[model samples]
Each structure stands twice: as structure tokens, then as C-alpha cells.
Target: MVLNMQPMRTDSTIPRIVICGNLEFASAECESLFKGVAEVLVMNSLSSADLIEGMQPGGRYEGAVGILRQWNGFSHMQRAFIEALPSSVKYISSLGAGYDMIDIDACKEKGIIVAHTPGVGNDATAVTALYLIISALRRFSVAERQLRAGLFDASRVTQGRRDPTVRTLAILGLGGIGLRLAELVHAFPMRVVYHNRRPFVGAPEWCEYYGPGRLDEMLAMADVLSVHVPLRKDTVGLVDEAMIRKLKKGAVLINTARGKVVDEEAMIRALEDEHLSAVGLDVFPDEPTVNPRLLELPNATLLPHLGSISSDAQKLMEVRGLTNLRDLVLGLNVADLVPECR
Candidate 1:
């Protein structure tokens, strides 16, 4: 599946960039941008073995200076893959906002600069979070399930439905996605409070800010808790049993962030015990395979991680990712380089 866009040239003066996956939305744009600047090689295979082999001494990607890969092109880009990359490979651009699948520490060790598509999918993902919040709060998933099973009793389905009016929404991270969701829920007139490492400057007056040390206080006041932080070493299992216990009883929980950020088992226990009135999730601890226990819960609303799959978002992400690679090869500053690299 590896197709060299151009034949190997004897002259090594021109830099080479290897595209590790297909760009369904931005192929033409990629060619136009890279024209005459760098030799482009398209690696269509999704197999890690194929990529590793291509990076070998005498392989097709022996002299590749940059790599651009699709978000789901292969499995984790960990230490092994970093070690396999040719010394000429100095930069990598991945088409997604969250680069948790890429081992930043490993990339650092190899002196590789990594960039990701950020901000382009914020609106799409924020809208998805808003959808989950409303659906969970209103118990729409339960209603839909009952209707599909021919058990459509209005009284039964409306038992635990809650309205967003006057409810307090506590956001765990007030980054771009979190702020967008905050603005969205303002339509419902829900009171918004966010916990961040520091106060976000120029925040709307209606949106209250809580310092990092006041997370428990914010959780205690929230009727709805939405998580929007990235998955990092310190954030994994951040919303564990103890943290979830601090939330107001019967609080609705929504997570569009990485699943491992919250302890799934602990959340499930809270739901079973009625401590959590409802739960909504777009990402799971083990993606593509959700826990059966969550599926069985009447109050649990779930999605298959389709937060940023809109056509517009897809095209923007592809273009930004490719631009990052192009800029790196051209010796320009990379705007979307991962924070760890900067």
C-alpha cells in the first residue's frame, strides 16, 4: 500500500516528506502546498510493521525529513516507533487536537518535534458535548431505549428527567472546548463555574472561575459536571471515587474528554447507587469496546467518540496538520506544535 508519489531521485538536495496515511479531504491542498518544495511519498498502509520497515536503512523512507499521519492511522506511536524512525525524520504532524496516543516523552528523547491540529475542531467537539449534556440531563437516551423496546410509557421515562434551568454547571477545564460549551449552555441560563489552574482572563461575567485549589468546593456546588481536560499522566483517573463523592448528590456527569480521565468503575458505582442521576460519555477507557455495564444503565448516554467528525472539522484538521509538516520542512515556526515540545 506504500506508493511513492515520485521516483527516488539521485540528488538529495531536496527534502522529502512522508505522508503516512490518506488525506481524504485535503489531498489536493497538500500537493499544492508541497509542490517543488519537498518530495512527497504517500504511505497508504495502516500497518505499523510496514511503517517500521519503511524507516529501515535501505527502505523507501530512508531520507524522509517529516511525517504526517492520520489520527487513527495506526496504533500508539510509542517509544518503539520513535526508535524505528530514521534519523532524518525530524518532525511529525498528526491530524487531531488530542495527541495522547503519541508518546511525547519518547518523541522528545529522539529530538522529534510533534504538532497537532488544535482549535479547528473546537466548535464541532463543543457542540457534541452540549448535545450529550442536554441528552443526559433530560434522560433522552432512556426514553429512546424504552420507545424502541415498545415499553413507551411517558410516566416511566419521565421519572428522573431534569431541566437545565437554574442548574449549576461545573467545568473541569476551561480551555477552548470548555469555554465554548459554557457559552452554549448560557442559552439554557444555567449557572456556569469552571475550575482551571488559574483564572482565564476576559471570561464572561456570567461564567465564574474557581482556582485549582478549590475543585472540591466547585464540585460540591455543581448540579452538572462536564470534563474537558486532556488525558495526561497527572489527569488519568482524576475524577476517581473520592473526587466523584465530592460532587452534589444526584449530579449529572458528562465527559467528552478522554475516558481514562475518569474512573469508569467508580462512575458506574455512583450511578448504580443513585448518587449520580445520569451520565453521558463520548469517549471510553477502552475505545471501540464500551463496558457492558454502562450499556445496561438506563441513565447512561453514550456515543462512539464522534465528537469532531463533522465534514468541516475533518477538512480543517487535515489542512492544519499538513500545514504543520510543510512549515517544519520549510524552516518556518510551527504554530500548532504540542505544548510539550514548545
Candidate 2:
């Protein structure tokens, strides 16, 4: 995709916003959406360190939008960027659902605003999670491999399928995407249970809610466990060796959540030991690079984080991020402000 940076023009007293990270984040279409509302700056040519240093302490940067795919986790460079945000920059809107890379605390402490594209990607991401659930539980990958290799014709083969309608699905996180997953999972043949920080007040009656130190119970009850939590201080490696061992024997593990949420080595051990029947993953601990061992495993189904790649979802996300920036610029309440920023 051709990336362009429009010359800074002040045709009116419109807001001046900065767009950072990869050229893909500041797509031409994304920049076009800001027309007549804000002056968009695409800082693709600048390195992260340069981005941080380019900001003058008193510059008139009213807002910033980030679509950093390579920034899988927050680092000192990101912290430095957050610290260097000009005083006029009231809000920093990120393109994706997770804002773990953006320093919420720094923004809150500085009285600057930060927002995320939360629900825009829900439908597509939830569908991807459900796809993993079915593919992992039913051994679709292995069956496909054998069929393509002519093993299916060479010998009689049989594998048991764990019907979703017949088993209970435990959703590990009940946030936007998780709730969407629950909405779809409830319609399937299986029962649904979810664990969140607190019991969701208005969840559908058919869906069960578990909270306040009930992860183990959730793990035990799950015939198919799908993780949906974010990566945070409390969630990094949350599912460790001990936790992996808590699964019901011959159960499927589905993680569309952050890969760091599950202990990769422990998970591999569990798979080898037959503690976990099969595993499906979208996000990995590292992006564009996965554990080589996982690729070699026959019981694992891997996806290259195709959760929110849908054009519809991506455009909506860009609109949402721009909306937050525009709203904050007008001194109005940002509809999609992160809780910490609010």
C-alpha cells in the first residue's frame, strides 16, 4: 500500500492530530476519514526513538492515533512516547482493541486521554475464536492433513468429534469480544459459562457467570475452554504449568487471547502428556514468529491472528479512533475513552 503524508495545512481552526507507527496503521483510507475534521499527520518515516524526540514540549498536537502492529507489548520506547506527548495532545487513540501497549497510567497521571477500538472488532474476532474451537476440538487440521496426504484412502481412519452442542464451553474473559463469543456460543448445542472480574449484571439468563477466584472451577467444567482476557500485570502467564494440568482430560484449549496469557512451554508439555486433547491459537507470544514446537505439533491448530482483519471491522476501528480524537478535541466526552483515562 502506498503511504503518504499530507502537508500540514490549517484551512480552518481544525484539530491537529499525529498518526504514528507502521504505514499500514495510517492507511490512506484511514487518513481520508479525518478530512474536514482534523489535520492528520502520518509519522511512518520516523523511527520510534525519533518519534519520541521530534515532539517539542509545547507543540500544538491536539491528538495522536496509533496502529502499531509490531508493538506487541509496551516497552520503554512507548513509555517515552507517552511521556513526550505535547501538552496540547489531550487524547491518544489506538487502532486495536487491546491498549496494553499504550501506557494508561501515564496518560491518567498526565491528565491526557487514551482510547481503544474495543467493540468494532468483536464480531469478526468472536467468529475466529469459534472457528478455532471447532477446528481444535474436532481435529479438523489433522484430518485435512491426512486427507491431502492420501492417508484417508490408504487406510480406514476414525477420530471422535467433541460436539459443541453436547459439551460445556467456558469463556475465560467476559469483555466485549468474550461477550460476543458467548452470544454465539449460547446458540450452539453447548452450554456456556464465563469468568470475569465481576458478575456481568445483564448477561442473558442462559449464560452462566463465575467470578471471584473461580478459575479452577471454570477450567474443570470446560470441555472446551476459550481464553479471551487481555495481557496485563495480573494476566501474563496466568495459565501456567499448574494451571494447564487443571484441565479435564481429553479437553480442547482455545486461546484467541494474548499468547502470553498461556504458558507456551507448559502448554506444549500438557499436549505431549495428553493432558490437553488439542489446542488452537491465534495470537502468539511473539507476532510474525511462533514457537517452532507448536508448528511441529499435530494436535495444535494455528491461525496468524486473523481475528480483526476484516475490512469492515478495520474501517470502523479507524473511525472510532478518529471519533475519540475529534471528540476530545472539541472538549466533548470521548464516547470510547478507556476506563483508566476516564
Best by lDDT: 1
Model 2 misses residue 170 by how many Å? 0.8
Cα-lDDT of candidate 2: 0.73
How far off is residue 197 in model 1, in Å? 1.6
Q: What is the per-residue lDDT of model 2 for residues 1-342, given as tens digits with 9 covering 90 to 100? A: 324466356654676676654444435555565667667665544455555555554433333433222222223235567677566556676777777767778777767777777788999999999998888877788788878898885323446556677689888877788788888877776788888888877778777888868878888888888888889989999888887788798888888888899998999999998889999899888777999999989889999988987777776776677666666666777667777766
Counting clashing residue pairs in each candidate, in order, gives 0, 2
Each model's lDDT comes to 0.87, 0.73
User: What lDDT score goes with residue 66 in model 1?
Assistant: 88
* 331: Cα error in model 2, Å: 1.2
TM-score of each model, paired residue for residue: 0.94, 0.85
lDDT of 2 at 335: 65
Per-residue lDDT for 132-167 in model 1, tens only? 888888888778887888887862655677889889
TM-score of 2: 0.85
Report per-prediction Cα RMSD to one decimal.
Answer: 2.2, 3.7
Candidate 1: give its CA RMSD in angstroms: 2.2
